[model samples]
Target: MSDPGGRGDTFCGINPEALQGTINSLKRDAGRLRGSATGFKTRFDQLGIDTLPLTKLLHVASWADDQLPMLRRRHHLAVLIDKGADPVLHYPNCPDMIMVDDADVSADPPKVSDVPDGSDPKLNADWWGALTPGMRAELTFLYPDRIGALDGLPSTVRDEANRTALSKEKGQLNAKLNKLRKDLAATKAIPPSNVDDVGGAIGGDPAYELQNKIDAVQSKLSGIAAVEQGLAKGDHGGFPHAYLLGFDTHKLGHAIVSFGDPDTADDTVTYVPGLGSKLAGAEGDISRASALWQSSNQQAPNKHVASIYWLGYDAPQLAANSHGADVASESDANAGAPLLRRFTQGLTAARAVSSPVHTVVLGHSYGSLVTGRAAVHGKGKLADDLIFVGSPGVGVDRASDLHVDPSHVWAGANSHDPVPDLPGPDPFEDLGGNASSFGTNPASTAFGGHVFQADQDPSNSFSSVDLDAHSSYWDSHSESLDNLAKITVGDYGDVTEAPQIPSDVPTSPTLVGPGVL
Candidate 1:
């Protein structure tokens, strides 16, 4: 019997270390056999003798080559299971007890109903660990949508499931788009005088409604294309393999793309974007994550870093769209807080045990508010560090309120970035005194967090705020990006600090300008 409690021993009736050893031995043997077969074939050809036997041997070697990867995958799955389990189960190496084949592995698999709710990351991890390799594969293949979005699953597994789901969704959206186009064409063909005005009277113009549907479908297709483009760049130019951890076309859309495998990384940064962030515009966000990864890797060349572009929440829009939330309000952030907290917890849960990760949660613009809410309301610490850049506020008056050490909380904003100057909600409604819409300005001295230099592309004129400064934090060769990378890799000593904004000074143009009272 194998000792599951011992390292390099069997777990869940599978010996991953043993499987790895077998795979290595088989590979070596296969290589030697192929070499011998080639030599034999050469000798046979020289003597004008048939080389069919040697060719068959070579074919057998090729078959082994194909099967080795599957066996190796099983080995990896077993290791993951062992790591996640509290007391790993072991079994004898007897033929009857061993999982010798896919059929044996799948036999009497656990029910999907046994899986815990996605809300609890620890339970989700345990449930996933209990399943055999074949059972997990079967479930992923059968229900890609559910598996792709499930918390506490491996990034590689979720990537595979999401890719399948993305393909199916793309096909469905394309079909729907085609039908809507046909409907639009048919509606347009009708004579204006003969067409019924009932739709217009009850709702809106039929043609206009059809056009809106077509536009929405087209937007979804574009978002899918963006995701595909991101995935296509696999480990090129120092950027790690892109993983589509989750995605959906509902409402303004949602996507979570990671530039590296978070589970195995030494450092991981999850970035959340703010207003006007939707699936269609996810390409920019994805690129930002990639940039962050590159910068962080450069800062800590030895440490493996993963940067995630997390647009998992339905961000509010500046103008009312199909989704009605306003960017000026905290409703969207309030709704996204729990989801963000769960995702961070899931990342922690699914991470490999041997390699502990230093997690950083970075939120930009309105996303800082969401991050703040998540940190404040969560039962435990949401991340090792929290970074807020170009933010109006973080839904909290002080850095300590975010459930992390004040020193670990960092904030940055360009001097000309107007968003940070926006007035928060009125603390005393009866007095009609206003403040930041979300809460206190996180970069202010009163907030008690380290303020970092992010004043890239400063506005030439002090009278007007530079709107472009708000989006330039992740720009190439920027101080802000460098500081962010430093913070992400836990190189706190190297981070450059910035002068904090005074709490009493009203910086907004509507209140008091830079030179004004």
Candidate 2:
């Protein structure tokens, strides 16, 4: 019998080869359009016509630029169709896919409830593994936000879903911001009335309220922009492709961005930031992860290294009048512990290789406490190695208390960073009182963890401990970052050891409570 679908085309009636050729031609046209737009803009600039009123009328180039994303989407769909692949699985944006209202509802893909419990990593992995590509793609397209946050799914799948979620979030936030700005302007246009005389219908300070809403929306947008910038870094630098594993804009916000694919990488490092960490400050955290990835890759060029910045937990903030659950207490760490544990377990459950991948978990300042609690969450070890830098404490007096072997646990504390010197719950006790506010100082001799060199720039003339030293642990070309990178890549012997805090150091003078010092 003759093939009715044409040669090399199975599912679709179109020939794959011909469609690919058309796609190539479309790509060429897109390139030319881009070039033409650039040329037009350049000529306008050269003629000083860009600043004239006529420039506003010359929007052809802008229109062309706006069409690029749609063309790119078309290209993506064409390529997928040529390969007979599932569109929802490979497509970058879910909303861009065409939806048919007449489509059969009974043919919908499996929902998250199909699994026993989506939060359980092993169960999630098993459920995902059992799904067909088409089903998986459909499910991902329908529930990008939920699927993206699920831990056991493949990193690439999560990245695609999360990118769609991010795009939708950015668009929504932009719209809200514009509306809020308009409202603020309208409110401002109203003459200022006496605060006491303003009617209850108008409420107190309408303009101020609108301005607050605008500020909040702008903050979220700024965070989204930061994430986009982080993703873009992968295109130019020698760095591997960046992945948005998870994200949320609620409250302080949350994000899990990876520098490389953790499932396939030989080595993976997950770094958790400390106090005051939020989505708006994600650029700095992402940069730190990128820096660590660069340093570790340099050490082991042949091995694939993935670095992840995990701000999944609500890190404590230093605020006046804040008593419990502040940076000084273990409330945040205790709450974040189980989540961190589940994340690490998900990493293990989602691995594609039978051979184990070396995984390291590093926490800075308050994050160390969270990491520590996660390590000791259950019977087994959470990570192959644990690194605590600028930590107040890890909620334990001894490294042996953590599930990992004492030898595999490491600590780094700069002399100028006073966080490591803060008093623990007990001032006089040998082991229990070593840490500042959490528990045992992991860098202390009593803790029995290896201490590594982590000094601030010697060029600085400051003689006192300060916040600058606490934040400089990830500085490029610094000893602290180099040591961290070495530990991350399993190059332990090369790491320079630093002196541990003496067990007998007077805890009385260091009894100052934490409030950001």
Candidate 3:
């Protein structure tokens, strides 16, 4: 069956005829795929890197190769093979990954006076207890994409790993691109022996395959360059330096970078961005985060503040055929919730109890759903304060249902923003899955949270404030930004609360732009 919408392509891509053909091919190539997997394991063994997971993953990927694009299948194999083949591979010795136990920390020689009891023992302060300086430095040489994914590592270590990984990727891509360009130049420079040769050259065009290769190489290079430029544009100078928390240059891309050290700050805010958020446009989110950091510091002059622009989750995309409506879903949020939750726990655990860091988790647009899922379902304490601005709907019915205290929860939405009006369908009620299933709007009185002022430009009425208003919550000099700043520094009393929407007023949008941000 042909799918009118792109949803079928995005998820399983399961068509009966195509599925049958794919299954048949997989069965035919089973022996070859196993042989390839064995070769991968042998190579890993020769390189002295862990092979079990890498080999098994490759074997599994081979079975699905018939269903995916050839390039994607190749990439899948490359990544699986790269687990052990990467020059910077580090296989942790322990059979199972474990956080630094309290016993381990106490037994080690005193490292720092401010080391908090039961804090994430993997933090920089306690780095020595987990790994020696040599081993730590060695990790810098490994592939950051792999290292950054591992939990229970120090934030700074993760940062260094990611930076190194990016540098390595860029360097490799540049070298390949340069070689391709040289080959193209050589092919173009070749002189035709005769005039007929030039006219008939189309039959055996020397540059055809080379040109295709160059285009493919250039495309890959451009993607990495885009991400780098995004990071550069958002770079800030001074005390609160930027730290790359996570990065991956695969499909759709993802990144988690911070404007300051969450592990050491007295106050930290991890801002989760919403719809249309990808690594390509990460700079905009990072810039907003930097502005929030500045605003928070200015709001609370004495306190140290940090802000993290978290783009770890694969957000829903407004595909070519998709309408602006029905973009919110539970799957992406559910997939990313654990990552968000663990990041928060690591931040909290890395701090000194003597000066416990007060953390605020802020979500904008679809990001609110991600934050909600992580906080409600994730293990341990995720954050001290939770703030949702311009949310579609969090995946819960009430503030009480969220693990955090109802008082600590705060919600804000611009009067003109259409997202807040999305009363998503209940998945249980709608078996067809066409309707919105996200829970009650947290900003609504029925949901129960401290509603804060996120008023748009008064000149722009509810009808006038378009989808852009959804993203303007952090606009400088706006009441919304001020309240957000105050909240970031834990000045809850200073927040200018907005009244709940009256029952009679229309909640859904009367006007929406061509796209949803």
Candidate 4:
């Protein structure tokens, strides 16, 4: 068909009403062309097209097959399921809802759930492999909280889902606040005497209802703001492979984020935070992770590196007068160990079988203890290399006890770091009746691993910062961070040795100090 303006209104019997419509029509033609051996040549001859316009049309038609559909079928299926309709009954081959049956999501009285909670590794692995990106995205919007917890899913999917859920929730809160504001304005317009003194009001005391709703909205808004602020601090400019693994807007603000994809990267570094670590403190943690990422890339430009800031478990909170300050007890570490193991295992399972990724876990201070528990109690190889810095101890009497090779395990502590010399005795007893309370000290010669120099002490330098010795491993121009980067890029020979501390130094119960963010 041709328009009155003397322009062709159709391309090869396909209407060019709009850009998207034209694209879709061309896509159908491309599909037909692909199915027929000589369709391309035949169409070219019929259109008398041998020029660039024909080439551009052919390219667009061919490319349309690769692009995701604007109206995703899975999302439409989910919308149907949300209503009372039986989607499977109507469309038997609706691929997205394969795992869910009519009984699973039926809402008359919600039935027992079949959707995996991410606890079952085998089930989640299968689920992760079964779904396509579009299907996963739809599921994320449908069940953000559930899908975000699944370890096997890609980090990018989880991040997108969480962001979508956050926006939806914020919108709901805003709507509620707007309605309350209108109600309040209407109530205020009436004189106090006109309003029923007792129970004549429709929704009870308008003032009380309005104030209550306003308080709830404000409280939720504050929580959202806190999460947003933490997210802003960790914003990585959406660099390739950067992701938010977990997010929960609540007290203590639980969130887990990663600087790279551990599953597919050639080298992966997982950093666990120690004391005083909370979701609110993610900015600082992310800053350190970003530094490590940059350093590793600079160290080995050819290698793909992923540096993750893992706050998967709740770190010990610092309270002025609480027993939580004493992290010597293995309770928190033990509890966190299983989750850490699962996280590492997930990384291993998700990677390509032919291209194995080298995984490293770095634990600082109390996090050393957390990593220790995972290495000791957890099954399978949690990581290829484990680095503990400024560690008190990894709750064992010797490094040999760790599942990983003693050679693969490493320890680093600044010469002046008080952590290794902290007043602490081994809390647990060995079979030989020897006390090993806080576990085996990783930095000790008896632990049988290489000790590297962190050299983070600022006291000997012109700087007078006190915390420098404890948490300055990643300081700019520091030898410690350089060595860490070397280790990350598999350049072990260049790492510096740790300065030896005498064995006869006075020892006390290894007490945990409040950690910095």
Q: Which structure is stronger by TM-score: 2 or 4? A: 2
Winning candidate number (lDDT):
1
C-alpha lDDT (0 to 100) for residue 274 of candidate 4: 83
Single out the weakest 10-residue window by summed lDDT for candidate 2.
Answer: 97-106
| Candidate 1 backbone collisions, by pair | 423-435, 423-436, 423-437, 424-435, 424-436, 424-437, 425-436
Candidate that would win on TM-score? 2
Worst 10 residues of 1 by lDDT: 508-517
Pairs of residues clashing in candidate 3: 88-142, 120-349, 424-436, 425-436, 425-437
Q: Candidate 4, after superposition: displacement of residue 141 in Å?
A: 1.5
Better of 2 and 3 by lDDT: 2
lDDT of 3 by residue, 333-414 (tens): 8988887886776675555446777889999878898988998874554688899998877788788777878998999978
TM-score against truth, every candidate: 0.74, 0.77, 0.66, 0.66
Please provide the root mean square deviation of candidate 4 (C-alpha atoms, Å). 14.9
lDDT of 4 at 358: 79
Residue 486 of model 3 has an lDDT of 94
Candidate 1 clash total?
7
Better of 3 and 4 by lDDT: 3
Residues 1-517, candidate 2: write the lDDT tens digits. Answer: 1123242432322233444555566556656766665667678788876544334434543564555554443343334433322333222233233321112222433566754455788888888788655456556766778888888888888888899899999999999988887776666444446244654224457776786788798889888888888788874679998989889898888999999889888999999998888888899989999999999998889998999999899888766665433556777888999889888888888887777699999999889989999898876998999999988888887899998899999999887677777755565653444656677778778789899998866775235656667788998889889999999989999999987667666222342334442
Off by over 4 Å in 1: 1-115, 193-206, 320-325, 427-435, 457-463, 506-517
